[model samples]
Target: MEDGTPSLLDDKKRTSKIARLSLLSLFNRFGFALNSIALPLFALAIGQDEAFYGVMVAAAGYVQAIALFPAGTLSDRKGRGAAILFGGIVNGACLFYLPFVTDSLMIIIVYALTGVGSGFTRTSLDSLIADHTKKGNERTKSYGITIAVATLAASTGPFLAGFIIDPVAFPLAADPLFRYAILFYIMGSFRLAAGIFGFFTERWLHDNPDITPAIVEEAEEEPDDSQELNGNSRDDLITAILFGTSQAMMGISSGMVVPFLIPWIYAAFNPDPIILGSVPAVANLTLASGTLFVGLQSERVGKIKMIFLLYLLTPLLTIGMVYIPIFLVMVGFYVIRMAVANMARPASNSLFMGEISSERRARSLALTRVMWTFPRQTGTLLTSYLLSIGIMGGIVNFGRFFFPIAFMLYPVCVIPMYLAVRRNKRIVEQRRQQRELTDSVEVP
Candidate 1:
């Protein structure tokens, strides 16, 4: 088939699927942002400390990591669409129940359930996208577009939630708990809609003749053991572990900012929720814009090089956050940081998908997610306790201290990432050489 020619699915059908996927991303992110905006405040409202909030979030992360691999395995065996739809429904149900529960333990239970749903939906959705696209550029575009849409939705969600929950503006709407509850209710409805849409969409691979079930089955059965044979000597399993550990570390770094940022801003400057929402909104918008650039230029830039460059810049951005004394400056620094951070995401994802075999892709992706979430939650829990002890009493002083520590750790983190990338590159080259040798022998 020509590159520009439409598949048997037709242009309209393909477009529809993409649209549904985009909407699904949007809704999922909306729910995520809503929870991010509300959860810490919910803990405060229930008279729980910051440490409790951290623990709650961490529990959710742990659950998500645990569920991700199993969910991916199921999606591989069953259908991706069914797995995603089922997960979405479960997520919606959890959100619906979230508002009604006041007990901390109950809240933790609900969050953990949501994490399970998250694992199912996200893992399946990514795999489905991979299954649909044959071209590398197209896959990158798809991921970039999906992330951009999610960022836009996330930006909107927090702003709306903040406006609704702001005590001064709404006066009567000052009930933070009720406002948060309503936001979750809306998010649940969004999830239900996405789930229904997912249920009706046609199978991604079925429409393409080039992607025969027999071919996929064959690929799955013949596990690629080239990595094991090559003197390259580095195990992908070990690399994956290192990658996951780095992700956990990054998550911890992020946790230091997220759960505390709003409350810190509130305590120091007493800004309204709307103003508080602006910080993340700005960050999300920047991220979206950066992703759009990546989508347009990805084919030209070469994925790995672009990702490496972006990754190197991230720690500097994090350190920059420490120097800004004013709130607006901090927001600006954060926006820049997020933009740089997101610029690397699509490339990293493409690298990951390209490196792994079809059968192992799901588990590999799950492993990455586990690393990302688990460490973040652990970091959040620890940071909350530290913050509770009045460690970060002053903004400038705290930033000066923590930023340098984070900066010092950045190079250490980069070493693992660099090694992994090199190892993957070598593996790809080895695979290419082996394929050529086999093809040459077969031609005789």
Candidate 2:
């Protein structure tokens, strides 16, 4: 393979690279999962309310949303491995500082800073994944495998963190604060482990010049009469914009209640930490299963159809959550909902990634991510305020007014992306037929 091109790597070498990167992803995801359950509880323990928790969550997203745009461009211009290393170090440092922050404001500030590092790591890693795998089915499968591996860590981290920190459950230490501190330390260690591993990985790549992928040049391409947009016939600008828009709407819908789910469950059901922790742990496990299934089967089933069917099932399932009052029933619904809703990720990622040119992939991905995060975070902030003011009042025994609105938006938001994908599919089939005709005429 040429230095700038990634199409020629032998299968074994590519698998090795993906494996190494996925290992790094495991460490990061575990750390994040620990904090995901812990952060809301920590806020309450420090005398802050759900509103403050919302602020903390939204602050991180706001920072990440701002940083991802440039991070993507940097990944394209500078390289993926280096960006991952830099992000891991920065993220680790912030997590290490988390235990020291007792004040609500400081906690939010430090956690928000973690977002900057996450943007760098996430953008670079996603682009690198695309770079390593062949496009279409293989790429989707790789994403599924990588994501499943990471989510496995996510499933376990919450269970462990909850067990260790729950004073009523474990009583490991006299002071509850001590347990929280210990949990944060463990989270920091995981992030630093990723940083250290990434550092060595980058060093090895630096030493091996032939294996390092050259930075893809993002120079403008000459206009092609046959192509409708950019240099590629299938790379439709409208499709990209529509996909991004749909994602942003989905984010907004989720942001309204997703961040507050654990807290809501705790306050409503009064479950112990173990049970509360199980929610996310189970959800992550189910998500891993769903992503893996979608990754493997998406090509066979058709990506758009699979995405549409899965998404359609989610809103119906979510509406059931609004009516159900039993904790076990709710958990079951939630588990199924998580599996069905998130299973669309790999297929959607493949669809979006396959449509963009390699040179501009990072930027386009960053744009779509920003669109999703900014709106979601904005919605989170709004929801927090509404919850605080009792504006998002309870709709029933179990549901908040925000809950149904969030799930209902799922199918609606997916519509534009569905249309866009169908259009692109049509364009691709037409081009394939045109090429066949050209080949037949030339042969004669």
Candidate 3:
């Protein structure tokens, strides 16, 4: 494998696997989009309070945290296929039950189970994709394509909900509970489709095995990453820790935004389903477009530089998300915000995973997720409390006040990433200089 242009589409096996994985990602996210809308709204309608809705939203994080480490351990030993299949099944089953669960606790419990399943499915799907692709450009492109498929598919979900059942209809609209439940049923169907895709993708990949071609640039002087003693470089640990912290902070604020954002917009502006649906849909489509460009350019633009710029812009977008007064303007800002924040994800992931030795990749990934999980739950709780108590005055608009604080938190979170990117660059330069010195001495 000399240094030449590598094409993922050139190989039949790789092409087939990537296609299946893309489809799997597409279905998985489509359900996720629907849940974003239906689950929180349903909880709010049933409980008639923001507190319970927050708690219910938090329940998924709890289960995901609990399942995270185990799922990783399982995937490393038994392979990712079974884990993903199991997760899809569990996720589908839980969503299917959501429509039937009328009580708050039951709603929380079902969502918790779905989160647990997601822990298994999402991590494995991620690791499995990483396993299949070549390092550097291929991996970045694969991730971007996979994410684009999923994002674009998910983008349709809100639109689908908007189209199917009008937010303001006759008898069904009269009862918020019944109106949202219909959407729940529709989301469950999407989950079922996702489960089927997961199973099929797994089986399809296994039935056809192909050794992924190694790239010239990625070859190592060493035998295997697993041979290292406990794959724990201080630099890697620091990177992971900083990355995880940034993710957690972002997650907390994001947790506050995603589940409750639509409901908040509806109350504040009273937008129709078409309007409501368009917001998230456009946001995701924007993300998909940005992701494709990021993938294409990240190889040349430099991943860290791209990520740093994106992180820098995040706080401004968060501010925009909070204070934009007009309905359509807010939606426009949200799309840009989502795109800016998420477009760098694959590149950031490439940087992080490149640091960890293969042996500890799963464990490191699992550990990092813990930092994100706790913060997300806490954010939801805090936001719900603010909403419940009317801390800033208006019942529906208290989030407006909290938005500043959350947006401000973005700066704090990004500090570590800034440090990591700079530090990693310094270390790489030091390594290059040392290598040159060794080569010079040897030549003499």
Candidate 4:
């Protein structure tokens, strides 16, 4: 009620709905993993270089950046379910077209279109999840369970895709390109299924009388407009901005490194397909574990504190991951760093979303994503350009240039969020003391 949504599902309804959404998201993530594992390799197979791959990824980000705000507004106005349904279909279709296209321009265009679908699905899904849960630990728990389940599938997808596509392993098709195409088709199928299931799931939730709009009216006889009219709206906006900026900084750091990891491995080590695939598989599995574990700890430790700690740890890990000469040791650092860096997300998201009104939640989330994606994409482009020109020496030097910058930025980014949390706590304490004084006066 405090978050400003029209309805809140009871515990029973909330549990059931969250379960359904998690399953749907699980399917989507699995499909996404398959493509993600294959796409860069597929590009490399097609004789394109790192710069081209960066351009390809950036194109999608660019389109996604453009679509995010409008998609958020659309979800706010129309319905979260509709946005999910539409996004699923559009995204699946775009992905389906990928294996067939050999032309570089067409590939970029189609891949870019997938961003539109992603924009709609991601914004709507987050909003829908937030809408269902109350602020604080409950929301964090929901996100943790959902991400854990979804990422469980994601962890497996890479291994499976690699097995099927690996010329040394299964080698279903004589042509490597054919193997990739087959993987793409399978990926598209799962994505399409996720969208269709999401639509039905939304319908099922709506049919629950307890979750209906009519029941929401009965639950709250009169709405309080004061929450919005008070200065809290200004504070909420400011908090949202700070949160977005922090994420953007994180994004810029990650964009340079995360997306390029597999590509970097391929270029530097020229490892086997299964080896290449295992990197992400191991990372995702750890990520799922880390996300769930950190989420559970977030409430106990305090959301802000948990976030700051994680932020501080990642920079140190990044440096180690960058410098360690041993391949497996470096990967160990990479995996741990990936887990450590991302562990704060559930806590971070819950804290920010808890403070924002439901009416403004989607837009605020979208704006935050835009801030993250734009800079992130720019970092990607910068890295690619540097790689293309041989400016950073080579791929090995990428970590040296980007990771240190990221290391510096990570600690700085947390400052704004820390300030916001302090301000919020202070205001809440003031309000509580004022209420106690008012009660004492009334009693006298």
Task: Report the lDDT tens digits of candidate 1 across residue range 1-444.
Answer: 686565544655656655766776786677677655576666777787666777777777778888888887778777777777887898899989988887778888987787888788888777766666533566667778777888876887767767777777666765667877877888888776666565555254465434322111113232453232232213646666667776766777766655565555555556677787777777888888888678656757876567666756767876666566677876777678668866667666655665556656676678878888877777677776776676757433554566446534433455566667677667667787899899999995
Best by lDDT: 4
> Count of backbone clashes for each model?
0, 0, 0, 0
2 against 3, candidate with superior lDDT: 2
TM-score of each: 0.83, 0.86, 0.84, 0.88
For model 3, residues 358-384, the per-residue Cα lDDT tens digits are 655666677678778888888887777
Which parts of model 4 are misplaced by more than 4 Å? 1-15, 209-233, 427-444
Worst 10 residues of 2 by lDDT: 222-231
Please, what is the whole-model Cα lDDT of each candidate in the order they appear? 0.68, 0.77, 0.71, 0.78
Q: After superposition, how far is residue 331 of candidate 4 from its true place, in Å?
A: 2.1
Off by over 4 Å in 3: 1-10, 167-182, 192-196, 199-239, 418-444
Error of 1 at 402 (Å): 2.0
lDDT of 4 by residue, 1-444 (tens): 666453333645655776787898797788788755687788888998877888888888889889998988888888787888888888889877888898989988998888888888888888877776656566787777788889877898888777877888985589988888788788777877777877777678667746421111123332232122133567777877888888788778878877777777676677788887887789889999889887677888988778878878887887787777778997898788878887777888777777677888888889888998998899888888888988767777776567656666776788778877677766766776887899999995
**Model 3 Cα shift for residue 169 (angstroms):** 7.6
lDDT of 2: 0.77
Q: RMSD to native for every prediction?
A: 5.5, 6.2, 4.8, 5.7
Q: How far is 82's C-alpha from truth in model 1 (Å)?
A: 2.2
Clashes of 3: 0
**TM-score of the candidate numbered 1?**
0.83
* Candidate 2: regions farther than 4 A off: 1-15, 199-238, 392-398, 422-444
